[model samples]
Target chain A: MLRRVRYELAGRVAFPLLNALSSWQRQLKRRGRKPRANPFGPPLDCVRKLRELMTAHYYVGRYAQGAVPVAWVTSGFPIEPLRALGFHIVYPENHSALCSAQHAAIDLLQAAEQEGFSGDLCSYARIDLGSALTGITPVGRLPRPDLLACCTNICRTVSYWYKNLASHFDVPVVMVDTPFVYGEAEPHHLSYIEEQLGELIEVAERIAGRRIDPERLERTMRAAWEGLVLWGECLQAGKAVPAPWTAIDGFFHMAPIVTLRGSEQCNSYYRMLRDELSDRVTRGIGGIKEERHRLLWDNLPIWHKLRKLSTLFAERGFNFVVATYTNAWAEAADLIDPAKPLESSAKAYTYVILNRDLEHRLASLKQLAQEYRADGAVLHSNRSCKPYSIGQVDLRSRLAQDLELRVLLLEADHSDPRLYTDEQIDNRIQAFLESFS
Target chain B: MSTATAIGVDVGSTTFKAVICDGTGRILDHLIEPTRPQMEQQAREGIALLVERLGCDPALPISATGYGRKRIPSARQLTEITCHALGAFHLTGRPGLLVDMGGQDTKVVRFGSRGEVLDFAMNDKCAAGTGRFLEVILHRLCVPLTSVAELASKAERPVTVSSTCTVFAESEVVSLVAQGEPVEGIVFGLHRALASRVAALVAPLAVKEPLLMSGGVALNQAMVRALEHALGNRIAVLPRPQLVGALGAALAVRNSQ
Candidate 1:
């Protein structure tokens, strides 16, 4: 009888109710009743204030010296150092994302599709190409890039992206080489990076037509270190009974850390966020109103699957307490050391992208799960993200045997919808939840 | 009794499925369950349970499909597209177009006369048009999943689903509800929105007939109706929609052996 009701409800009441709820939430946002912080931790207002202060300061710094043409480059070589040396930083990822959010991505993506770029090429790439061709940002927000520095550590796409950007902008391009670390960074690799860093400094000095201010560079590095520590602390606070924030919130709040790493404002903002998270921990509030099972997520979410998966889990009384990728940003922030700013900054920057090694990724995930007291781990075997997809089976086996934690391998993609099936996925999730019981 | 028996398993994002078939593509028994912590273990257990239910021998050779196929420790791991094609061919007895909508993603596969995958288009990144997207919308609406089709049928005018992102889409749905839009119209609109998105993906492929719909989303009548309207043609849905991938895998295993 319950099954019959559920079956009926799926088609009739559920669909309409969902549409109504979605519309209502939008209205609430427009009315200035911002989403409350998950009662698990920290007030939303506090986090917002901190974020505003940090971003404002960072922007002021960027605009302070005649508007340094800085591009907030994605995960790669220490572009912050270059920005400090008086160059504009451009982040293609951010621009591409803006296009996506604005619904301009489809058109732009289709344009790129005509240029022989496979439909499988990173959506970000397609969006970027589209934006470049269209010469129009969704909301007229993205800044034109002046210089392109492609770092090879993340993937080959960075090089290709820079090549295109350099040609389009007719600017000088720099390529930073970091040998892939199979397991751990070696002294030789560190020395190689140091040499590249010195060269980068030389290039910046030439471009700015100014001498390097060692003290100012040191100061920036110090601020970056402080910011990282606070960020790490904020992430750790999620280990509290009700995590202070969700992964989605963390993603939204990561802008400062990524864009303004070497600024005092970033540190202050994180400090405020940390305090609120700490307060939440003290209050013992979980993100979910009623938490039943706490689970850890591995890899990026299958974007198309997130809603269905989130609902299914919620219905079954399962709450995702932590995710390794989300916490990784915090870990990267923690690596900054004010005392040894340059070395720490270099190391911290290197840790941003996750194309390094299986062991490194596994260790980070294991630590997060343990800290969060996760009952189970759901690994999304994403097809498009090869860097993330590899070594999952080994990781799953190890996590289960070593940590005695339950692990489920979910096959899906971060963006592609054709890769997964609903009924099969729900059944697997339901079974996994039942096993937990 | 059939001289040959084969097993097909689909390790989906959220579930593990097994289908045992006779030599002629007749299903003997099938099992579906939420994927457990260990996919390999869950798959093995699921297959065992199904075989036991059907009183079949435990030594049957198994072929796996879906995203988690490689992780199943099965003898053969085939792609979901391959499985969908085979399943469609078996169910419809002809090769045409295959549309499989799963939790997180959707696919439109073009099959040749021989049921080979000629070309396919997939949407996996965003949840906008997939089953997962519907589930989220359903939860926010406090409506049961089963009622979506009926509610949609009552919709006089289609409401627009403004946001493509599931998170934002939910907010959009909520505001619509607040505006006092009829639940039925909104439901119909959501299905239309999803169908439109799916249609965009299917538009690239050379859509042939008989258009066979597989995967979990095929059960959603509203979605099916919307898709049919979008394509301006009728689609054939299998009796057990979710088992298509597993059936495809079973057929592949039998052919290979």
Candidate 2:
């Protein structure tokens, strides 16, 4: 009872009010601020709401330990069922990315390294395990999980990461392994996932001490599907001559779809974002003030250096309109059918970009490039992500050969900055941009 | 042909090269030296020396390339990749895959028929496939680069140096010498390993014929032969190979003007 009141008073009430107050203060300050020579366009109006929404989500998480049932899940995990069961979902991957962007990850990464975790291990797993070991996070607190859900649709690393989490927090872990799709998923491949979903629901019910409600699950599924469509519209807005938002901005805005997919609030956020973006497109406003060359980005973003990279490209008049990473979220979810939640969930989540073949990935890249009229592409050959970075060399050559686009394969880790030297990487970027000039 | 009126400076990681060129991109006067620690001052002095040698005006338009290009005060700055492409095109007058093995990095650049950089691939953040790889390993074997061609030519059976990493390969070279391995064969094996590593980078390029080689490493006949044997193509070494990047930088400013 005390936990419930604490969650209500703090998570639901206090954080929302405080976040709204700060958002208004920031807006007022912006209004009174002097205009300066900036390369970016006017800040998104929906950005204020995005801050308020994510702030409340993380702030309220501090009091969520005893107040709600928590399930820590991977980004590719099917989370609608957990949402229906009144479980507060904690996406450690999202939190790790948040820490990286906030410049607080290196401390946590070092803490994990001190505990003998290999420097080669994925940064997300290291941060998750590091925070668990040292209890240090930029987000005030992370709730202890009652259940841990991992899906192999993204990579095999998550299963091991979650297993380590289960041992640390002493919780039940449920894993969903999706077979890598070659051309198309066979019936057995999907049935195997459906069977796993059944087992997950059974385990989830045992933990919640309640039978699963069918209608509630469908409602959550419907909400998730709607949120994905809205998010896709926001991404397609980049097809405008002067794209409404850059793909770097899409990386941050994608947090809600990844974390809060099944919630009405998540859907509403995308709705506002979609409207605001199309509004910008109509007014001929670009993410950058000068959008001379449009480029396509492949693989995950370098989270720590987002600002430096975005500003560098903007100053060079190169704006990224489409990214395979951002497009990963916006695509494939259209396969969802909320009426048959479990069956469709099995199929929709099975065909993720990482889980699919290289040919599929290439087709997607080519299509996005053509649709957006990208003059060139930059593929970040990430050190930490093997699954995403493996075929990029071949893909780079093929993209250049087929599309005749000036493609650059940059070697840098998405999380760790130590793997690459600045002068070498920057020199390549300058030359790549120069080729276009 | 245009008169010699422009200067090009290549402030490389290991060695620096400066050249005075005509508007038609022909080298007239040049300077080459090991890079000093004071890079900016060293670059300015080298440019001054080349100008003095040719009795050119100090106000000659200068274009710079290489890793240290940005640090140098030039009218224009470009990366070694672009400069090397333009430079190779000037000498060979044909486009193909050009492998430029410099001190710190190696690039496999495919030039279009018209001399544009069609695509290029650089060795990753490692010194394994670079000229520095052979430099470090040969230093461990007490072998000068000048003697590499002579030594490897005499080796009846070239010994194998398997490690692709420069530091690891150095240790392996030490252990091999201690194990009484032939020095000529060891030198033969070292260049072979560097050749294979660069070959892997070029395999994916799929460029047309007329393969070419440039940079300071091209001066080593053994390394060039090893690369030809590894790639299975007759690689033509450009004229005054090491001056290609400097030549390209000089041409850029002259052409733009």
Candidate 3:
């Protein structure tokens, strides 16, 4: 039928054209391919042009109307209720990182850094400021934020970040506070967060000037929870011999789950991704051609060293089967109770990122290693990120004693390339691997 | 008469270097190799090879330094800053400033009298100033490592590498090459550009000399020269440049014992 004809067209014509375009682009950038530009024509014009194209698609299309009232909520805020309320959401973390990769984040980041914010402050903050100043974001990217919200459960950075945004836009600001849950959220803590959730609903209703639909919110929460569960299931599928997908690919697809949490589209995407992964699992597909040793990666990657490290691991048959960050998302999903929506939403929001205790982080990593049947663990002692980098040495010792796991502490920065050395890192990895044999 | 020989390993990001030294801080043997998958084994093997080559005893006390030292179980670990200062001070016979540029990271160490570390600044998270970044660009250009200095010597104009990230800088270098800029010119620009980055680390410390440059990157004459030019002064390079970390570790072991 028509579907078959369309598929034929896509396979025969569209795919080839796309492939050719990609190859041509690659060729253009190859060494010795083109003449170098003058020292100062338009610094980062390519980045600007790309951002313009992306922004046009994101903000100017018919989908713009369909764009649900979206807000950028910081971690530690009760975004579940907003998701439940059917509002579109976006995480600035993902967007800032995209901006960083595009090289546009430097000017903006420098502005903040020069303002006496140490270079060690999160790059995301600098990138966000950069995007606001430059107006360059990916094509068809984030919808404009209609509200700015903050919570204190995660880190103090968000309050300042949101305050800056609110001042920029002259928009209303909503702040939520959730008492820290030492281990798990108690009933009182839940009640406190629940009260804030109620206030959020009131504030949101006032801003939108619309009647709040409780049933719709409940439905959204249920769907969002389902989507999160499915996403976790997809990650679990990577536990197979070859690891059906790499962490980089997982990060790419994590968008819909983070931004469109309550929607049918989010649910459908996860279901589809889950099914595709399941198929890969059945077919026994692996990420690496050679399966040597499986290792657990602790903390965030040294962004500057990801490729080198991945290549190093791949060449040696050491696949990073599991990570603590990826697993944290799913754990939050399990805690979301759609029936008692607001309280659960608050609880979920309060617990994310590296806000959890050191022991919790260690336990999660150990669980992933055990579940993935990993041979060893590589802990990147990230220099720029103190919050994520702390307690790794202790965790390494504990894992060695309890799990009897071999551990490697690799010092590097997640984004800053200045902190790592290939000769040093490579030598250490070689030594660690030979010990396993 | 016992030699009292000891082994010191400097496990860097891009290279695994080891040195064997007698009790008087005289280097007997040394080895430098690309860090492989089995780093500790590589260190052990490299040390063993150095010992065998030097006709030294196999059963020497060992100490480790640099980023990967904690993972190497054979020796007590010392920080790169401390070790670099010790090595520089030992080589120069004066305590002043030390600049160590390894594969992936850069550091500027300030030493007080008697080689005590006063304070230090490091550019460890960024790649713009490190030796690994130079290697990546050189590999992309299909140029031998030794030719980089020669290439820089021919540059008519310096091309600025604006990226703080090494990956992005590689693309920038590739684009420069594609633009048909002379390879030598580009190489010169790269060294100058990287020197500027290292200068940023050094400038903050306002370090006084006898300034010493150590680590693998110190072997790059062009970079060393460019760095000297950037700082508007002369810099000293250790005779056994790569052994600086290992030397410091050995010094630490000797002092501790």
Candidate 4:
């Protein structure tokens, strides 16, 4: 009982105080530093708030192992029920992305490869496995998970990846098997997922040693839906000619929705972001000062190379106004209903862009191009994501024929910078941009 | 005869090419040589050589292209894809599909109505079907690139060389030679393999006629004929095909100035 009290006090008082102090130090440093000249418009002002939210999240997480039920979940896992049950959720994919952005995952990835994980496996899986093996992470520390939640909505590989984690941590893993959606979810598919989600709630409650409050689940669902709506609005602001934000900013700013979607804080963060973006749109502020050509990006971002890639495009007066990957979060928000939480979440999670067919993807890309007024598309034939990368060759040809949009199929990886070659991609990108010129 | 207005230099993987173009976009003087390791120094000397030969000032606007283009100090640096498209369009006076097979990569570039690049595809991270593949395999087989066309023409029936990798194809050639397979047949087989790979990149695009060819590989008559057979389209080789990228680079400099 005393241990529980200490954990609560640390989470509520010490963690918050430390987080605030660290944030203040960061702000002071930022204020003293001269702002680097960006050929692009001003950087997002809400980035400080984003940093505070994420820092507080990790800071609280440091004490969460004893204070709350901790669960490691996939990005597409139905997390509302877990959130309602007082579980501190951890997204391994988000962590992997953080490692990639910091350029710290290469050694971890190599460690996993040395342990016989093939280089062809998803870098996220490899990084997570490496972290599990070494307990090395940039977030200071990760809370030991009391439960493991695996969902097949994003990729089949995650199911196996989480299973490996389950064995390492010796935790009860609740697997939610979402069937791949071809066109639409059949009635049976929706019910099947709904039933699994019910079972998931029971497993989560049993692990937490408490029954979940229905009102809390509903509240969590509403917050998640609200966050989604705000995120959609933020992305729609890109439709403004001379878009307010580049897709690179979208990549970084998406962290809250992915990690803290069920929380009211996430909704508030997006609302702030939306207002900022709307103000920029009204002011005629472009992501880049000279936005000559707008392009759409497909597949996962080269996380480690985002800065270099963004600067390269900005230098050429090209800005990616929209990305199919970033739009995925907003695309399924319409299907989510807080009143019918279970059924809606089942539908929303199952019908994610990754679970859908190539035909759906092609249609999505076409609609994005037309709506965003994109003159071209850069399809990263990501080495790590087979589902996203496959059929891109055919899609490239079809886009040219149907829409007359110039397309460039760049061969690179999402997280693993080792798979990317500087000179080769530079040539391809410059040539593609030259076509626009 | 028009005098030089600007110079373009292409420092490719295998060879270096330079072109001095007049204001009318006519090639007044050009030079081609095997690319040496000291790319910057070699490019400097090559550009100086062109200036001396053309009796033009060294201060003339210069553009550079190809893999080693970054090493060459110039007024502008353009990728070979853009240069290839510009050169092909300038040569043919029409926007059409262009197949440029250089030392490191093969590109199938489609041109818009106004001669701008519409789209393009290249050999994916592989040296297969590129000039380097042919260079390596032919070197192993003791066959000169210049004599390959004549040798392949003598074949009654072409043999099949299925391996697309340069290393594996070298061994395949050696094994075929040891098996008493005719050299002429093997030569034609190699050309057919490369032609088929290039054809795959072109198959997706709409090919308007007077389909064009550029780059050093266009000089191989057998390869060109095999590519025509594979693509089922007549390829019109541009004059001074090897200098097309350099010509485009020079023209770009002239246009910019």
DockQ of every model listed? 0.02, 0.69, 0.03, 0.75
How would the candidate models be sorted by lDDT, starting from the highest? 4, 2, 3, 1
The sequence of per-residue lDDT tens digits that candidate 4 reaches over residues A1-437 is 66567667766788778878887887788996888876788888998888878877876777788778999999888899999998989998989988999999898899899989999999999999998899999998899999999899878888788888999999999999988888887999999999999999999989999998989999999999888889999999999999999988999889999999889889989999999999999999999989999999999899999999999999878999999999988898999999999989999999899899888989999999999999999999998888789899889988888998989899988888898888888999999988877
Q: Which candidate achieves the best TM-score against the true structure?
A: 2
Between prediction 1 and prediction 3, the one with superior DockQ is: 3
Candidate 4 docks with a DockQ of 0.75
Off by over 4 Å in 3: A1-68, A75-77, A84-86, A140-143, A351-353, A383-385, A416-431, B1-257
Lowest lDDT 10-residue stretch of candidate 3 chain A: A38-47
Question: Which of the CAPRI classes, incorrect, acceptable, medium or high, describes model 3?
Answer: incorrect
Off by over 4 Å in 4: A1-11, A20-33, B154-160, B168-186
* Candidate 2: tens digits of C-alpha lDDT, residues B81-181: 88898899888788878999999999988886666787888888889999999899888888888888999999987789999789999999999999999
TM-score of chain B of 3: 0.93
Candidate 2 per-residue lDDT, tens place, A160-254, comes to 88998999999999999899999999999999999999999999999887888999999999999998899899999999989988999999999
Sort by TM-score, top down from the best? 2, 4, 3, 1
Write one digit per residue (lDDT tens) for candidate 3, span A32-98: 9665432111122123232333332233321322335556786445666676554545567656655
Ranking under DockQ, best-scoring first?
4, 2, 3, 1
Query: By DockQ, is 1 or 4 better?
Result: 4
DockQ (0 to 1) for model 3: 0.03
lDDT of 2: 0.89
